[model samples]
Target chain A: MSPSDSLAATGEDQLVSLLTQNLPQSARTLHGPGDDCAVLQNHDSSSLTLFKTDCLVAGIHFTMDTDPARVGAKALNRTISDIAAMGGQPSEALVTLALPPDLPLSWPLGLYKGLRNAARRSHTGIAGGETSSLPKGAPPVISIALLGSVAPPHLVLRSTGQPSHIIAVTGRLGGSLAGHHLDFKPRLAEAQWLAAHGPPSAMMDLSDGLAKDLPRLAAASRTGWHLLPDSIRRHRRCSIHQALSDGEDYELLATFPPDLWPDLSAAWRLQFPKVPLTAIGTLTNPDIKSPPLSGGWDHFS
Target chain B: MSPSDSLAATGEDQLVSLLTQNLPQSARTLHGPGDDCAVLQNHDSSSLTLFKTDCLVAGIHFTMDTDPARVGAKALNRTISDIAAMGGQPSEALVTLALPPDLPLSWPLGLYKGLRNAARRSHTGIAGGETSSLPKGAPPVISIALLGSVAPPHLVLRSTGQPSHIIAVTGRLGGSLAGHHLDFKPRLAEAQWLAAHGPPSAMMDLSDGLAKDLPRLAAASRTGWHLLPDSIRRHRRCSIHQALSDGEDYELLATFPPDLWPDLSAAWRLQFPKVPLTAIGTLTNPDIKSPPLSGGWDHFS
Candidate 1:
């Protein structure tokens, strides 16, 4: 039964009672369950591995017509991006699918084809997955989990962005809706180069458009940012809303120092020419004069 | 928008074309987008870390009358149990939620309470999660992904049951309907203890009922099993169908050296006494002449 029925009966206190009352101190976890990925040290090396998984559903996140391969690519890329945002190299991934009974075998098989195809291209394998069929009316859903590694001391993170840093992005924006959203590759190469070199100040992927997301990096670093509209990619027919609210542009939105701009740009072409790089803004300590922007894609808002 | 609208768009080959042609070799993923859990080794580690995630929807996996906390609990446990079945320890987790619009603000909030509550008990944390609301007609859905560690030099797997090994389970079966299904603990502690100590031969969580699950395990191990009916628990009122077909009993069913029974029981007591332990059956060393069990759970069957 739903929690309300229990609430109507035993009240909320019973809720905790029904849930485990005494959890163990947790012995085997080296870093335990709250982090970008489960942190496990490589006994023989100076680095650690990072892992994560994410899910998106059709109708809930996208329509069925969304390219099956991009859906697969995005699902895989999103998790890999998590590893990248943390400044790690993604080396593996797994996908699980939940389909409605009416779902065509080919639809999910297509999703897998997309998933495996993306995996193979990345030198990733189809580790394996479970395909479950749900009752009618249930939407199509896909979930993927990925694993990657980084040298010990330099995993980049949202909490790492600091005041007085410059915020940077790789690649142009505003045109993701055309066909790029589904086929974008995660910045695994870019992240590896940055990690092996040095921290990029603070970083995150611009999945949700930058207008709203730039501030999150700012907030995570406890800083505020200034963006010149002129520096951002803008389509003639697209409004700032599209730039601010559109999701699925999996490019690296990172922060570094102004002096590092030359190095960042130089590194992008020599190492990652297939993925474009750009400078979108700068970060400063948040203050009364420049309030932080909190206007991203709030699910409810 | 489904592939259903375009007959020309269906087929595994079509999916393969969309996915394979555009994959990049730069990602360095040893395995991606398939397998029970993506297996990867960083130059840093000698062993592999397993990652996975799945979603449970209200009205689909449960009803409105279900405990919101239990719903949250089950969401995490479902995946954790999957890890347990593989004899791994879940070290980190992430969640994504899609809620119904116009529900009491307390709804999602209460669900988070349940989520954190489970995390606390499971020794996991809230980590990171995304929340969004769907226009009406969307059922409340919660998705969770977990990052886990398998001991180096050895990782227990779901597809590696052996012939002639004993199949043992901790806890009674066939009575999840008695309210035990909603809030079961993943045998994380027990499974880890087993992995470190005895090493169950073939393992997996029993979610889709023993009848259906046993064969999958047997097939994975490349063997058949003879069930000792007396070893299985059952409710007097529970039909053979319910005993074999009901889903959502988060118990550990594993096979190992028959001699390890004593040590395994002691470990179970030290780790999961709230749950029972029993030796249920043995795996045949060779293709058996007669099968002890008649059937397994099949949604289509």
Candidate 2:
């Protein structure tokens, strides 16, 4: 097959693998790709540095008509959320912006203001980044790279959960398209609490919906999961399927030992009264066969 | 005046300032924007982490016809150069790519291969990043974020040079558009050597040409510079003016104490026989006035 044909047939996952194939790993790298963030061992050894990058294209993440400040804020939040998913505290961020040459200066100014506000809220200092003009007809793109820190003991990974662990989610999911995607706060505090207390065995942010992301966590942990359809939480306007399949929820999906669920659930409610922590399923044995689950948003698909 | 109109008149630098204005600085941020990289104090006070991001747009950095591998390599190299300029060792990188949905997968595969090759050459690992599809007509964009480390003493800054220091540049300059820009090495080894030896008082990469970048180094150091037109080393095909005004040279511009030039120059030659270190100017007192120098490439202008 032609190179393009072969690449096209394999899709995004295969393409990423092809791109990263055989790349050397630094001795400092503790956890590389296939997770919410790459964790690198710091010279101190007591703390690990978390690195994550998330990009937002105008048409895909927001439209030209979307408030520029919100767009900027979302860009910062997306990466910050990833750090949160890793059960870490964000420390700094670098932003890269690509804009049309003729774009009015106010748009970028407003966008920066939004980014500054979000960074302040998250206590993530905007460090250094680059800005360049795009081709005339191209859409503006904002990409943020975040650096965070996690105490080695408190660090969580999607690959560490064991079968029979109770699967739980923080906050409600689904209906993010109704504007929650733009304004929802990342559950940084909640993740921190989970890491410190029940200390989730595996954790990730639900940017790609439960149906798709759950499978990822399962695959990474070398296990399987079964969602209790009746236990799925949804927005008033959302169906159970939408709760499972719609993305951009920015909530945390975590697994805890079944023995800790009772106390952990109580503590979560006491700590974050406004956000609900619900038990939705259990991680299954790797050998178990389950019916196929609906896939979530895939940029390539 | 309307915000847009005000921003338009102020331009990119002003926009960057306005964007960063009133942003809180974390206690961990030892250095922020306005430099090659942001230096964050690691939890272990002995080592500092360096952060930087640079973006490349299709039409602005290269044309669609440019080799895909070169595009990927350039993206990785650009950020690596920033780390090099800071006299640091790059450890990890995250790459964000935005491409048109219909783009041939082979193009991305080629781009990844190029990125992987460059990362290997620098011994910098490609950690994790995000990829998303752009609007149909939008051009592809690549942005890279690099994490590196520098010993406190070996760390260099563009704002630390003193008046009367000798200004020198590594390698040739100008006419990079002829194809040198895409393929030039990042001078990482040379920078590491300088930091370990005479150690530049201030340093930066010549991505925007001497005329423009020299002023930046001087301004950051709170000084002025006088370049001897005859002393500049340029590409054979480049004119004196082009040598000063053209950008993307990716060479190192460094300032050293006048007393150390003889020893530093001799050592540089002995260490890098193929790369010429040329003394072209001297940093002047901040109050000194010189004729207006030509500005380098400005994204907004």
Score chain A of each prediction against the true chain A by TM-score and list the results: 0.81, 0.96
| Quality of model 1 by C-alpha lDDT | 0.64
Considering only chain B, report the TM-score of each candidate against the true chain B. 0.80, 0.96
Ten contiguous residues with the weakest lDDT in model 2 chain A: A1-10
Docking class of 2: medium
Give RMSD (Å) of candidate 2 vs. truth: 1.8
Runs of candidate 1 exceeding 4 Å displacement: A1-45, A194-199, A235-241, A266-276, A288-296, B1-48, B132-135, B152-155, B158-162, B189-199, B256-276, B285-301
DockQ, every prediction: 0.22, 0.65
Fnat of all models, as shown: 0.17, 0.69
Would you list the C-alpha lDDT of every candidate in the order shown? Answer: 0.64, 0.86
Maximum-TM-score candidate: 2
Locate the minimum summed-lDDT window of 10 residues in model 1 chain B: B5-14
Candidate 1 per-residue lDDT, tens place, B147-212, comes to 666755456765667766788877766767677777777778777778777777667788778876
Cα distance off (Å), candidate 2, residue B289: 4.7
lDDT (10s digit) by residue, model 1, range A1-301: 3533422233222332343223322343344332345455565567776656667767656678776766776777777777787787766565556555555545654666667666665566555445444556666667775666677777777657766677677766765767667778777777767766646877777766776667656765777777665666654566666765676677778888777778767866888776666676677767621433444444443
